[model samples]
Target: MSEPILSLEAVETDIAQYHILKGVSLSVPRGQVTMLLGRNGVGKTTTMRTIMGLLRNKAGQIRFDGAEISGELASSRCRAGIGFVPEDMGIFSALTVEENMILAAVSGAPDRARLDWLFTVFPPLKTFWKAPAGTLSGGQKQMLSIARAMIEDRKLYLIDEPTKGLAPAIVSTMVGALRELKRQGASILMVEQNFAVARALGDHCVVMDDGRATWSGAMADLATDHALQERLMGLSMEAG
Candidate 1:
């Protein structure tokens, strides 16, 4: 395979006295959604934070678009074409939906063609274009968060816990929207806890546990291996 759009090798991070990530390494191939999956507290979110430079890495290398990004500031990373949709969806409650989208807008005027594309992929965003982000439902907020990231024209996107509290129907819409982004040549490294959605959207799967990558393989292989899923996620096929 060609070099990944994003790659982390032996990334380690410490919070206070606690070591959250223990040499975790993974890569997101260009134009694919590489799902990071595991049980809660498995360092999935930490991995995303580390990639975004929110949490400084104590060890290892992080490369974006073929250059080392471990020491880069968060703002520098953003300018270098890395967008994030945090677990909280980080929308400004006081801002209107359009304002929220505009806040993340890059140099060029918001891409009208891209906005139209987003409207087609995420219908709720189109319906709530005029609504305040805070007034919108949880799913709507997630949709807006995603739209903001897409507008950045980033080479890679790190989305954490995208479906945390959204409705089932909305989750389906989000998955479809991500697939559309992938088709448009954006590389996504998403942290997803929902098995069905992950399996459906991910081209590759990486399982993290206690701050380390425990398993990784093609999504197709992961779908067939019940034992692997059970070992990493603490869930069985019968329950899944």
Candidate 2:
């Protein structure tokens, strides 16, 4: 296996008075997808936020590309090539699709070639290019959100639930786009509740429970072991 592009060791985070992530540790191998899996309210999203530098770690270290980034601001992290597609699909509702894409680029304008390719990858983005983001359907919003993070080439992408609450057809489209990214050798840390999606996309898996990383290994191993799946994620591939 290649060296990890990102690693969190003994990391902890607290939300005001409540301790959230406690001693979480995991690794994302370079150019591979690492799935962050857990039931809801298990601090899965919190762990993603912490890695993206949104929630400051109260203790331990967060290292990106072998460098410690624990004290860096979120913007600095973004500038360092970490793209985040938050769980809420953090697009500005009032902005047009064009505007959202433009804003995602650090230079204030997306590269023309990449923009064209993105439009192909997500045709609806081109169809509704001038439409306000708020007017888009849920699936379109998700496409826009993913496109924004992908507007520029990123070293590592922190994605939270790309398949959540979407129709199966839409989910498949999302899956196809993500698979393309994987082919391009993008390193991704994604939080997914959909086991099928996770199994399909994840190269490595990190199972979290109660703000702690409880397991880390190959996705294939977890996928084939129904007993392990039930113990960690509470479902086997057949049921998931």
The model with the greatest lDDT is 2
Tens-digit lDDT track for model 2 on 79-164? 99999999999999999999999889975678999898888889999999999999999999999999999999999999999989
Local distance difference test scores for all models? 0.86, 0.93
Model 1, range 68-161, lDDT digits (tens) per residue? 9999999899989999999989899788888887888866678888788888988877787778788988888889999899885788899998
Locate the minimum summed-lDDT window of 10 residues in model 2.
Answer: 231-240
Q: List the residue pairs that clash in candidate 1.
A: none
Clashes of each: 0, 0
What ranges in model 2 sit over 4 Å off?
none
Candidate 2 similarity to native, TM-score: 0.98
Residue 182 error, candidate 1, Å: 1.7
lDDT of 2: 0.93
